[model samples]
Target: MITKNTNLFVVSNVTNLRSRVNKLYIPKTKSLLPLFEIVSNSIHAIFEKREIEDNYQGKIIIKLIRNGDESTLKELDFIDKYPVKSFEVSDNGIGLNRENFISFQEFDSEKKAKIGGKGIGRLVCLKLFSKMVVESIYTENGKFYSRNFEYKKNIKEGFDKYENPESEKTITGTTVILENFEIEYQKKAPKDLLDIARQIITHFQLYFIEKVIPEIIIRNQNDEEVNLLNLFKSEFESEILDDTFNIGNYEFKVYITKSFNSLSHKILYCAHERTVKDEGLSKYIEDLRYIIKDNDSLLGYHYQVFVLSKLLNEKVNEERTNFHFSDDEEGDSESDDDITLARIRRETLLKVEELLSSFLSKTRKEKVEQYIPIIQSEFPNYASVIEFNRDKVEKIPAGLTPKELDVKLYEIESEWKLEVKIEGIKLLDEKKDITSLEDYKKLYDKFWSEFNEVGKTDLARYVVHRRSVIDMLDKLIKWDSNQRFYNEDIIHSLFFPIKEDKDTVIHEKQNLWLLDERLTFNNLLASDKTFNQIRQLNSNSTDRIDLIIRQEEIFDKATLFSEDKFPNDSFTIVEFKKPYRNDYVLGDPKKDPVRQVRKYINEIIDKEIKSEGRSIEADKTTPFYCYIIADITSTLEYILREEMFTKMPDNIGYFRFYTSDELKYKAYVEVIPFKKVIKNAKERNKVLFDKLNIS
Candidate 1:
């Protein structure tokens, strides 16, 4: 089937130039990357010339071209500057000779591989600029020649080579004019000359640090020029540290400088003497969240950290914008032994901390001192935790709010508790056969100490809760700016939630101790519940009571036995009236709290008491106690007189006993003001509060 003339098919490698350009990732924020690439190339070109001539000095000129209707722009008073349309970068270096021209035509050329060239920076330029034109004059074999070309994205060959007349001029140089800046990229690019200079200096900081940088200048439309070298020297202070470290068989060099003009602490990763990635130092070291002030000079400055490594240079992507390494160790499977960006950052950060130890120590000490009072006064529960974890506490960052500090301390405490628990479990699991007496005693002492610490932590938490409740009560009793007091329902819910009974609300959820500590030891308690809803009372009445308590003998288990077996039952009822309310109508049970309690007592006495399907004790002979909590208004005083109540010596309350033969019951009633209740509670818990240093 094959003959000598049988045509042989040829397969050529096909590449979609447009698709390749589209594959490049250039964020709007990095719109100036294309310009940086051009500058980098110019630097490389200048370096190439230095190899040929020992006394050659490199010079690069960047001229900004702008577009605007001069007449119209003059008429607009708000127009300060015209929009940039293009840029022309001229460099005095090895121009595009025959070998350079061939390299330029080849895609991903390796001609400049020895100098860390990716050979794809030109393509990156096309991502932002629509057109590129190159004009160069160079010498080959001592003969002056000229090469001119125009590059376009839509062209098949990517550019058109133009023939230029041989130049008799002696100066050799290259000029690349990038035209038609894309609107999207133009919006993100820096227009100010100072900003442009700063960007260039930041991108090429490594060369500046090494003192091998050329003289680079940026000129505006009005011929105003800024020398980048001078700008760098004025804005960046002396180098702070120059060090090297190894990461997994790779050596990385870190150069740190104190920058007087930087907005924040920055860490720039460089590859091939060009910055590839930048991150804020605050992301790792919290103390660097803002500009730091030197203690000796009292000048504010931020650090500019530059890191260079051969591994990074070799791992740079084709676009030269980023590297192939993962940012975190956890993202890579071989991170245990292999190098990662995060590991490099960790190593550098350790060095940074070591260099700035004095500053960090002072900052931490001041921050901890500022936080101590907050913990002692409002957050006493964390006092012990912070004391034990002093070293960890000193590492906490500054400028955290009280709430944020509380959350962080809570995390530290939880971690400590977990560690203690684990250690205690391990100790308990060990066998005692091989343990010496002294060792056993030491272990036992340690165990007991930690055990007591756990108890103290629990107690501290409970005491903190109590203090908060007391503080809340103190504020609740005060009048607002409007001269209005909180309603009775608001204060009632603070002591015990409304519309709930013992079956629905747990004992711990109620702050019954605020009223009377003995009330906390109740057999049954209900708040804002209807008589029909109480399980122990056999009544169809829907009258709701503010609060009701039933108590039996302390040793009696009422739930396990019949109610009749515990005849020594006592009942208590509490009613809360609106604070400072003087509207009281006697003889109307609905408006008078005393009559209301009487009505509830009579109804309960008439109803049989039962528990767990067992008939129980009668309540007529039981001793009943009632409390009327309200301010001693004039109308309330008149009502108290009518009820034959005697005022206490303090003149803030009244008490009386009611014995009705017809009702066959004896009851004691007390009318106490809200102020008195708060005062008594505070006095009772003052000693405990003092011990905890809480006010």
Candidate 2:
């Protein structure tokens, strides 16, 4: 009786009117984050049903599969009636009856729902697969009813249809099957199903641990139950949240884990209220999405922080929320409001910083010390350039791309041919005697002794009782010697890169060295080495220049001035210095050797090389001069300002290096510009292009 648009004011069937606008269908994007959110919602759905029914303790089983008979088959394999990729999520919590099932069919654009709001989670199943069949049971009117939704032709005929049968079932739970879906990343040979299983176990480990020991069995292509838990054990323990704090009426749960080598401090778990959506760092990170709120509510904008410390000094504020941590002791008392949320962000960050410091102080520093030998023995070429010291701790600089720097790190460390291997005793039975407390003491003593000798400054005795350390090391040796014996000479190694050439060029700083010591360059040379690895590590005037012999490479500091003559092809000469331990300590040009080398290189190129009638012609010679500092630390910066040179030679090179600890601490390097080296475009560009054409 009513045409398509004739009776638009009908109020009796308003549900269908709203449903038409909401469009209870799936989005056409491939993202595992949404899948994760869906599963998370289902997990809570069961729990919420239990809570509503006053069911205190119940179990929910969730399964993910990639292949099946009625699978969401990829379009390419549709004829075979076989699914190339499929997944299943089944739960045993309170099942959905007629109302819940129909409610699941609703989609909220504004994300306003009493139950997990945005019931579009169901559509996520559809997004990941072609057709999803939800088998659910509901206990209402003193009877249990079973129903499902399958793909069928819609009334329009062009769109897919939703078809299912209603029946009665004795069980009280739900099973969802997604069929005929193509994995955007993998279509034919999809990613291992175990990966999805592992993710389910990992991201929701706490959820399972607090409730049930999830009976997760992953099957290989052969269909045998593969042991997914064993592989997940290492990560599961690390993800467990053992720390708790509070802020702004929200309860914060925190978990922090350091890398086995003790170089990284990561936040494994951080959440607030009953959900991970509203408070701490969300899975979806952006400039605007700062505060995680329940049901997509906005809490704050950009609320994350990190801090470092050398020792424990104060009580961490357990009550503060919505903040981050900073170990800059000088700025602790400063207002947090200066950064973002100001007072709240600052104080919360201070507490987290203090917590981390306390944790670090209590932890033994010897874990990272053992890697030095592995690096030296494994990557002889670049190992000598990097120096890792356990006594030093370098925090990240204030800026962006710290994580991008990590990506560049793996390339360099891998190219450098470094490996991670352990030296000393073997394992016997289920335990390793080499890990005994006594052996730890011995290694500890040996470490500090070397530290004192090389650093020339004995640490405070109270740091670790020397006598106690001797006794511990003695016990360790005796225990491991009597047990499984692994020769100490057989050291383990982990291969890392020195320079990895990728397609994209990252610009950052370079650590230069003019001092008489080798230095690590990862922290400072992300952009510098990236340019070099990409054959772009030169100024505008001389890309063909090679054999960059430095004073530290040839004659030590004392004899550097004696060599006034440099090779004709030595295109660049750069000098640099390691920054002071205390970054705030302004550099003294008189003491810092970088300025001296830069000056010497300039004089040699300007007075000696340029005077010899060297031409920019292909037959003639060219060289440049530059200097690099270990960091932008205050000391090195101070020297740059104090020495104050307006210009430098056209044909010289300069660069700096990073501390070994800082280099290996992260995985990537930042790019730094050599603006000073290419100041004279016309002359320099001519020389560079000429060299390029010659090459």
Best by TM-score: 1
In model 2, state the lDDT of residue 495.
9
Q: Name the lDDT of candidate 2.
A: 0.36
Kindly report which residue pairs in candidate 1 clash with one another.
Answer: none
Backbone clash numbers for all candidates listed: 0, 88
Ten contiguous residues with the weakest lDDT in model 1: 1-10
TM-score of 1: 0.70
lDDT of 1: 0.77
What is the C-alpha RMSD, rounded to one decimal, of candidate 2?
24.6
In angstroms, the error of model 2 at 38 is 4.8
lDDT of 1 at 485: 81
lDDT per residue for candidate 2 within 1-695, as digits (tens), equals 21121112111112333234236443333335344654555565566566566634544444434454323332222222222355555666567654554455445523224322455554444444555566666566676656544531121211222323344466577766555554662353325455556555644554444433434454433343444455456655544334444444433444332212112222222221112122342221111122223355443122223221111111222322222345543253444222222333344444555554543343323323333343333222222223432222112111224344333323443432222111212211235356688885765555454333333211221111222222332332232545642221110000012232223312121112212123212112112231223232232222211113321233232332324654333223332222222233334334454434333333333432221233321112332333342334455445445545222233222233322342211111111112221222223234423322310
Encode model 1's per-residue lDDT on 220-332: one tens digit a residue.
Answer: 75667889989888875354577888877888888887765568898888887777778999888887887776667776778888888889888787666677875553343
Looking at candidate 1, what is the lDDT of residue 161?
Answer: 53
